[model samples]
Target: MDVDLVVPGLYCLRPEFGQAYLWLDGRSATLVDTGIVGSGPAITALLTELDADLDRIVITHGHQDHAGSAAELRAATGAPVLAHAGDAAAIRGERPMPPPVLLDWERPLFDSIASNVPPNPPCPVDQEIAEGDVLDFGGGARVLSIPGHTDGSVAIHLPRSEVLFAGDTIANVDELMLGVFNVDRAKAIESFRRLAELGTEIACFGHGDPLIGDAGAKLRAAAAKITG
Candidate 1:
């Protein structure tokens, strides 16, 4: 994994498959996601290189790839961990991986990814957020409760910057598309539509390169395709 500055304060920690982001703010920063197990050391190293102390570790959902290192990082930094209430138990490792309804072609890929994530012990969630909740980070980021990838999946929007931290709700891996292998595809599509309506100039995804310009339009196109 390597770290690259995507924007002035947004740094993308690009991992092989999954990704994590650091929102830099002087000496303190907020981590959007934690990559799979054994990713903690690298993440901390990057944080040190940036001279940023971890202020909070915010999880976008319960998926192992997205939250695997949350406990380790939280303990390492003494930072509170936050996630949506619906997936808090799963993020804490109290619940099994949500069974996904997937296409035949996606089954093998999904299984391979699932097999690689080591089981993590329970991690306490310091706070549970929901839609309309505004976190005191990056000036302020509004939480959009977008369920589909996982029941508590969310997108964090920085209106002041027109940036959307779009977890797995929407992906730009090969193209702008809705999250694949969802537990609830319909709900995921609905969430995609909601996210499309947001005016975003930059979009950060959990599994792909970020879209840096006119992201809202791309999201709208993806939503329309999904809906149609």
Candidate 2:
């Protein structure tokens, strides 16, 4: 795992398949997402090296790559896992994950990677979060319910810092674009537009490099080109 500093108190943890972020507030830290399974030890080590204790673990959605190590990390650090109620059941293994309605072009890619993706163990969500909830991290991170990547997808916005943790609602894989593999493309597009309007200067995404400056303008530009 590679740790990249996004700012003075923010660090992005890049694992092999996905990314997780660490937000520090003095000696306490909040984890935005937990990368795929087997990422617990690395993350725990990182926290120890930084001398920051994990205060909370927030899941943007119920996807395996995003929430896979949540349970493990929670166990190791004793941090409560919080997730949206809409996806809590799925994350807890009460129900199977809802499959994405793949676009024609996405099918081939999805098929190629699906088998290699490990199944996430059932994780217990200690708190059920929702839109408008302000989490005690990054100077009060506000949760914006941005469904369509999954019914419980969300983006964490920190107005004080002008930063947004856009969890798969938008991606910067090659360039800024809407996230693919969605259950509802239209809803995802709407969510993407909503995030673009936040006007944040910095944006962090789940699958790509963080947008450090003028992120809102870039998002708006990308959003304008996205047609239903």
Candidate 3:
């Protein structure tokens, strides 16, 4: 419920199917991921509350829930969208990969639905991130290419706050195991293992709640489960 004031400089914009995070670094702001299609209104409401102008939308991946509303956000704010090149197709709904979950019979049925889900027009990205590359979003916030969840999945790291916006490239992907959705099982696990080494104090996961207090310890435990 009101994650806006609680999160302070950044707030959560929970749209249908997915959630978007907003951070204000002064007059300009940065949004991490755009929710699924029809999320334009949620974003607008969040921005209005923050009273900030969005300068950029940083996509963590290309999945529909993450990029489906990218074009809309760009149109509304004229902000530049930046994503990884490997996931360009997914963002465009070109080589869209269906979630490898759902009941056995639901796969094919969902495939057809996948073809019909409205693809948000398209927006040319202003930048393509590569592994190890860091994007200084002014102030001390930066973006890191964490990959794994998708070939191009990225995470936003705020060293000043010791908070990392880890986008599904995590160890215990509880959602995937519960048959929510997943793309590459192996890659996702590997990405989680890598983060275990980050020793971040607080982790802002894309889903669920933030990992606070002993995140490094909890993440290590999750990493162990992945290895097993």
Which one is best on lDDT?
Answer: 2
Error of 3 at 135 (Å): 2.3
**Local distance difference test scores for all models:** 0.87, 0.93, 0.68
lDDT measured at residue 33 in model 2 versus the true structure, 0 to 100: 93
For candidate 1, write residues 109-191 as lDDT tens digits: 98898787676557889999999999988889999999988899988999989999989888877788887889898888888
Ranking by lDDT: 2, 1, 3
User: What does the lDDT read for residue 219 in candidate 3?
Assistant: 76
The deviation in Å at residue 6 for candidate 3 is 4.8
Candidate 2 has which clashing residue pairs, if any? none
RMSD value for candidate 1: 1.3
**Tens-digit lDDT track for model 3 on 184-213?**
656666667766667577776656656666
Candidate 1, residue 169: lDDT: 82
* 1 or 3, greater by lDDT: 1
User: Where is model 2 more than 4 Å wrong at Cα?
Assistant: none
